[model samples]
Target: MKPGIFKPLKLKPFRSLFGAQLFSDLGNWLDFIALQVIVAYHWGLDETAIASVIIVLGLPWVIIGPFASVFVDRLPKKAVMIVCLLLRIVFVGGLFYAPNLYILLLFVFLKGTVSALYDPARQSAIRMVVPDSMLPEAVTLSQLSVNTMKIAAPALGGGIIAVLGPKSPFLFEAAGFVVSIIFLLFLPSLTSFEESDNRMAETSTVKTSFWKEFSEGIKHIFHAPLLRISIILSSAAFFIIFLYDGLFIFIAKQIGFNEGNFGLLISAVGAGSVAGSLLLGQWTGWNRKPVHLMSSSAILSGTFIVAVGLGGLGFLNFPPLVWIIGACLLGLLGAGESVPYGYVLQSETPKQMMGRVSAAAMSLQTFSMLIAPAAGALLAKQLGASFVMIGAGLATTLLGSTMLMIIWKKSGSFQPIRGKQLDG
Candidate 1:
């Protein structure tokens, strides 16, 4: 039987880690929502400018995170986490007084860089503390924190911005960092717990270059047509979604809402995500015919996007509450696609190659994040946000339908992937 979710909370080390993780999660939302508000409402920046800020914030994760993850294995996890938290506090502080957008972007980039390290270190730390058997429960508890807080944090952040001014969320985020660091201090010096001991160590082994390691991952994917195609499709979906992902502020405006209600739009998504997670966690049908599941989810997501487009074009005059409901459905559909894709990824890849496969996949998504936002925003500018949103919806629907048919026709083309080539 699976352990109860709170079972891990009984342990001292786990509690500290949980608390720190909680604060950090909240900080991320506060930072994100605050920055969007500052750019869209306060400074009144255009769509392209808003997209630029989003790209700059994400660049470090794309460029630095992949390379930095290799070092997480070498470093003391606790120490790295603490140092990153300190840097985050400083970086968020810079955002507080960043007189203009350029400086704000710089600080956001720096903050994002350390975040790349901190996340992996925190995950490593969890493995050090939690018993292997309760790993599932511990992870569930952690995700509970993430999803629940995700629902709360955006609303809390918007409330802070509404009353305390846009920069105030940065201050709260800094304080959150401080609190996280304090709890993080309680974690034992888990130095080299998962260490490469002398007995098992291969002294003659020369470390391969990052590119070489990455190439190995690429080879694994390409060798497995199912995994490769699935990853490419997943990345394509992400690219399409993110094209208008950062434009929720403008979307809200078009739908007859202000900055205050923007958080409602996002919070509803979080609620939907939580529901979807719970549903997928229980449902067994997702494992079989996952392509159909994802395609259906994508179809619904496109429908929701079209609804938003209609709202933007004044064709579908949804009330504020109805719009929020639509956002929730979109979120639910998103979680639907992601959970099944993860299952496919796990089933397709060998255990030893999991990290590299994930990293390679992340690189694709990051590239999408870097390029799609600017392109979307530029299109939103030239042709107007409404028409772009409509085109985006139509395109997503087309992509999903086309992929589904292709998979149905060529199911035999994707063979069972694992064998000597994968093992070698």
Candidate 2:
């Protein structure tokens, strides 16, 4: 690899890809914060309505995302990435001119659809460039960027919304997309177009049925004891853990903080997540102990979330200082779950098939994200947000422990210690 942009990364191609990924993700963060503010203030949307919009945005990935892997494999991966980026640039740009709620929702849906297609290509591209031994570190470092970006971007969005109008953030988001496109164009070629063309030509003739590839991906995951258990546990845990989306504002309301303080509250969780992600990145040897680490983290995270709900309800709760600790603990759980999962996916799967396998895992997370808002909103409305949050936390803790026990029985190992390598 040439030295400069490629120094920390083992491969030049991966360095370019990483740069593009970072800028694109930054745009996504800005869009999310800006749009939610529009809904809350301009449209006067209540919690349920806001949650409903989020559910709609998430639904397509669960419904249409599986097919992306098969299609991504057929196309030149870099070309596919560029195409998706262009599509997002066009679609998301619509928000700047209109900025109405209906138009905003449409743009949100378009962005989600674009992401569903784009994600598979990005996953496959990593395998194309990076050496296998470096995957864990790469995955960890990538997540560290994501967590760090998460910490700063939302606050920036909040500040922009406060200073300028709502549309200011959209303009910034558009600028980020443009920057990503420029980075992608500057990327040095990996496989020659001719080589990729020849590689496709020499592979076995295309199967007649499209779903055959999708079925194979699903079957491979189910056959792997660790992968299957991990997916199930993570999905269930996320469903419960994400109640914070609904609970954050409610708790803020309960504690008598104004709308601007909402940014600070979110920042607290982001701070904790950033710390956890950095710790995991620096300590790359924990890949084998994923099951044990995930279980313990989930248990602790859920316990803290339950405490937060109790604090809100004033049920034997301490002062606001204690609540901050609870928030940080919840963030730790978030980081632990995410970092290990990324390492497992990058390390365990064959490079060529990573797109499908990753899509399969992500499909579950998409559904979990979809269900979370609805479930959280309904429970918050009917019973009470506090009760719903407590219940969710308890449920997540139990689910993680159960999944760990089952996986341990099958593999004779519960922790994430390394063992066999799949044929790439």
Candidate 3:
């Protein structure tokens, strides 16, 4: 259901932002795979060590998330993004000559920390530039590009590595970051929301403590019923699905897949995601968000993951075709699940507070995911990959259902905003 061509990327600021983001994302995929390969083959790292490198990359997102939101709100959105892109260029460039694992890890940590600030700023920028009517389509287009890169980038990285060497990907990534920085440099400063009257007054008259601002954001999320439900549901979803993050490689290995097939399996999900984002973009007339979320939550959470577990049951026995089908099915489920999530976030939060609220939501989501990879890895090691998948699927389904029930009782329907509200 995607447009024949990209729906004209009309807004100048959005056009520039999107262009910058696309190149950066592409380069990031390249760098990540290249770095991992360098660590594994060139440096002779074990699986655990390679995983440690990945963990270090994600650590900044976890540790810096709350504080990042505060800074994102205070800084000029475009400036924040440009600075982050430039920092990445420098950090990634350092790896070209040094090319050492410990140094690379340090760079990754800094990149991740900076990314935590940039992401919120970018999202807030989107809210500022895109008109409300076009927001959904904008989100779809952005997601499509991300998913497409995810599906295609690794293969491209692999091909590059095969031809040039592991270091080639880092150099390519560095160049991509530079290109992103170039695109960002042209972005206008006007594409950002101004601080609300209350916030501006406080900033002007009273110098508030950083912790106070941070805690206020946290309290606002918990005290606001809609945000409360959104965070709760999102966190639950993250926790339940975290198991899959943990067990993916293990599952592929159990089912007689090599690294190539594992990459394909991940790509299958991206393919499905692309398909789902397209569908959501085309079909946009939901009156009842809560009901839709509640119903879909159980169905989406349990169905494909259960299928994954079911398919993996024959891991010791199944043919290649069956494995392929299972991967496709899982992909379909992943695609279906993502569309409703964006609407839930957009409709549930106030526009002015979106940056901090979004950060809070993401922070909780990360807190949930923090345990998923390790737990999934441990479960796969102890029980069996299939069992972990099944357990995760069921846990996610149950949690979603429980959250949905709470929303339904409190709100009477799944729709976060009324149809009349959307019309005006």
Which parts of model 3 are misplaced by more than 4 Å? 1-8, 195-198, 202-209, 253-260, 286-291, 294-298, 315-319, 412-424
**What's the count of clashing pairs in each model shown?**
0, 6, 6
lDDT of 2 by residue, 133-248 (tens): 67666776677678877877787887898899876888878788778778778676646532443223333555644567678778867766666667777787777767556677
* Model 2: residues with Cα > 4 Å off, grouped in runs: 1-10, 45-49, 192-209, 255-262, 413-423
| TM-score: model 3 vs. ground truth | 0.87
lDDT of 3 at 199: 56
Answer with 1 or 2, whichever has the higher lDDT.
1
Top-lDDT candidate index: 1
Question: Cα RMSDs of all predictions?
Answer: 4.7, 3.7, 3.4
Model 3: per-residue Cα lDDT over 1-424, one tens digit each? 3462245377788888888889888987887787788889989888877777777877777678777687677667888888888888787776666557778788788877777777777777776676666666676667767777887779899999999987888888878878888887877775334543125334543336566667767876666565466567667777777767767676677667887667767776677767766765676553245334434645664765766676678634677666676566655555444545554555555454556767777777877777677877877889888998888778767766777667668764333442333223
How far residue 324's Cα lies from its native spot in candidate 2, in Å, is: 1.8
Candidate 1's TM-score reads 0.76
TM-scores vs. true structure, each candidate: 0.76, 0.89, 0.87
